[model samples]
Target: MTPELLRARIKGGEPLMDLDLRQLVLTPGDYAGAVFMRCDLRGVNLAGVDLRDSQFIRCQLQDTIWDGAQLDQCVFHGSNASGARMRAASIKEMNWSDSQAIGMDMSEAQWVSVNFVKTDMTDVCLKGASLKQVSFTECAWGKADMSGTRQEQVLYMYGDLTQALLQDAHWDGVVCVESDLSGQDFHGQTLQRCQLTECRLEGCNFQDALLEQTNFKGAFMRGAKLINARASRAMFVYADLQEAHCQGGRYTQSLWADACLDHADLSGADLTQSILHRTRCNGASFMNAELEYADFSYADVSRADFRGSRFMRTQFHRALIAGTRWGNKAGVLEKDPLLFEAEQWSAGRPTAPRAGY
Candidate 1:
């Protein structure tokens, strides 16, 4: 059908079905309340168009351009939008389920209350976009670019965002549960109140990042780089951080209960007020680190290095200190006067100075 006829049909509240509108330029048109079923709109240019309340089912939108268009309350199911460009579009209350949007460009777009379910948006570019109340369920966004994007109340569940770019993105109240974010780079980013529980963050780079109240419970962050990062009040319960590099990082008031940090390098890290209860830090290095007010109760610190580390009020009660090196000295806890005194005090034994006669 011609574009004029399509517009007239849409104006008359008629649904356009089984139409082959491929390679058509429908710029500056209004297709509100349109219902497109099994339509082929490949390589079509719908720039500056209004497609509100539209329903696209099993449509072919490959290489289509919807730049600067309004797609509010739109539903796109089982559509293939590979290589499509929708830059600077206003997409609110949109539902895009079972869609393949590979290599799509949605840069600088505004998305509000958008739900993407079972969608494959691999290598999609959403740079500098504004996303609020957006939810992605069972989606695959591998290598997608979300740099400089602003997100609020965003949730990603059972999805794969592996190798995705999130540099300089401002995130608030963002939760990514049971997602695979492996090898993703979050260097120098500031994440506040974010939860990445049960996520696969193996080998991910969080160097120099500032994370406040961020939770990584049950996460597999082995070999991850957190050098010089500030992770205050963060939770890493049951996390596997083996061989991870956290040198010079400030993990104050953080919780690592029941977590594994074997062979992890935490040298020069400020772990003051942090809890390592039942955590395994075997062969880990804490040289020159500030462990003041840090708790290591029941933790396995065997063969760990604590040279030059400040231990004011640091608790090692019931902790395994076998073969541990403490400030240029290597021996059992019985030989170390400082450790022995702390242990004695922890056991309710009086170690105070004797009163003068």
Candidate 2:
């Protein structure tokens, strides 16, 4: 009955604004270009409707199900869409910015060129969705379920991905910039070919993960764990890895140029052909590690430990080695006579540091 009025409104070119249409069931309607502004559409089931190019401005769309509907080019501006379900919908080119979309379900939906800026999407379920070129800028994704999603060219700039589920998802060319993903667990997950540039990854775990060719340039990964991970040719250029633990990791041919690895533990790791030019390795440990053909030119290796490490053909040109513990390390550094300095300080050197890592 109300859909007939909606059809009449569409036919008369009258905009639907400030109406309490909670009982509106938009079933089988070609109400294209329908404009719903500030309407109370809480109980409206917009299923199987052709609502293409519709505008929903500040609508009360709580618990509204638009499953299997065609809502292409829809604009949902400043709306409160809590618990709304749009499952398996063809929602292409949708703009859902500045909206409170918490707990909204968009599972199995085909979202192309979608943009969700400054939205609070906490606990939103996008599982099994096909998202291409979707950008979520400055959005809060706390506990959002994104497992089994097939995303490509997706951008997550300045977003908070705290406690987001990303298991078994196939990601291609996804870029996450300046996002706060601190204390997240990505253990044994494969994030290959992804870019996490300048993101905060403090205490995040990437244990045994495949990170080949992934770029973490300028990332702040303090106290992060990458144990036994295979990250060949990965880029950590200008990254801050202070107090990070990468023990037993395979980092062959990886670049760590100008990186801060202060107090980091890379013990028993394979760093063959890896370059650490101008890196700061103060108080770091590479004990029993493989450093074959690795380059550490102009690096500050002061007070660092490389005991029992294999250093065949390793280059350390002009590297500071004051207070460095090299226990029978098989390598000859062509150091300048002036570069060799003496350890001038140390009161009571205990078996470990005061801050027991």
Candidate 3:
């Protein structure tokens, strides 16, 4: 059934079945409480219309326009709506599961209590939108624009958000477990109590972002850029952050226990009162980085590079340090009693220091 046929049927009180309304134009129309399952409404113009409580199951609505439309309690399951326009629309309690909606624009829209489970929303634009209680499970949002979007209780569990733009986006209680967010742009974004466990965050830029109490456990963050990021009491336990760039980032009482940070760059980073127990930092660079009262107990510093790094009371207990560079820093190398006894400095021996003193 086509759109005209469906409209005629609605006028004549008839039922629609398996309608193929591809490229239909229904602009400024009232389609409230309509049931349109398995329809092909591609390239349709549904602008400024009322589509409340409508059902669009398994529909192909690619390149469709629904700008300034009202879609309350609507269901769009398994739909392919790529290149669609839904700007400034009111979408409350909508279901869009397992759908592909790439490159769609929904700027300044109001999305409340919407469920977008397992959807591929790559390159979609939702800038300056109002999202409340929105749930997204196992979705791919790579290169998506979420700048200046305001959201609360948004769920993004196991989602791949690599290279997505989230600049100046404000999120509250966002859950992102096992997601790959490598090389994503998160400049000036504010996260409150966000959880990012087991995610791949290599080369991610978080410049001047506010990450209060963020949880980043077991994440692989090699060469990530977090310059000027404000993190207070952030937890990064068991994380593999080899060669990460954390320049000028602020950390107060941060926890990085058992982290593998080999060859990581922390130039000019403020790690005051931080705790790093049992960390493996072989070949890590901390040039001009603040280490005031930071604990490094039971850490493996073998082949690590801490040249030109500031250290005050930075403990190094039982740390292996073969060929490690410690440039002009006064610190104690506490040896464990259970390890082998320290040998004396013998002249003309293989294990002797140079006689340049």
Q: Write the per-residue lDDT of candidate 1 for residues 1-357, one digit (tens) a residue.
A: 677888889889887788888856674667788899999999988888898999999999999998987899999999999999999987889999999999999999999999999999899999999999999999888889999999988999998777788888988779999999888888988777899899999999999988888999999999999999989999999999999999999899999999999999999999989999999999999999988878888899999999998877677767899998997432222234566788778999666787993
For all predicted structures, in order, the TM-scores are: 0.86, 0.87, 0.78
lDDT of each: 0.89, 0.88, 0.80
Clash totals, every prediction: 0, 0, 2
Candidate 1: C-alpha lDDT: 0.89
Candidate 2 shows a clash count of 0
lDDT tens readout by residue for model 3, 1-357: 455666666555443447777746674566677777777888878888787887778888899998977888988888899999999997889888889999999889899899988888999999999999898888888789988999887878887776677777898778777888888777878886788778888888777888778888898888777778898788889988888877788877899999988888777888878988899888887777788778777888787777777877776766777877888777543543333233332333486587995
The TM-score of candidate 1 is 0.86
**In candidate 1, residue 130 scores what lDDT?**
96
Backbone clash pairs for candidate 2 read none
Which runs in model 2 stand beyond 4 Å of their true positions? 11-13, 328-331, 335-357
Winner by TM-score between candidate 2 and candidate 1? 2
Expressed as tens digits, the lDDT of each residue in 1-357 for candidate 2 is 477878888767788889898876665968888888999989578888888888899989998888987888999999998999999887789899899889999999888899999999999999999999999999988899998888888999998887898877766778999998888777887788889999999999999888888899999999999999889999999999999999999999999999999999999999999999999999999999999989888999999999989988788878999999998856746453434442212333445657857
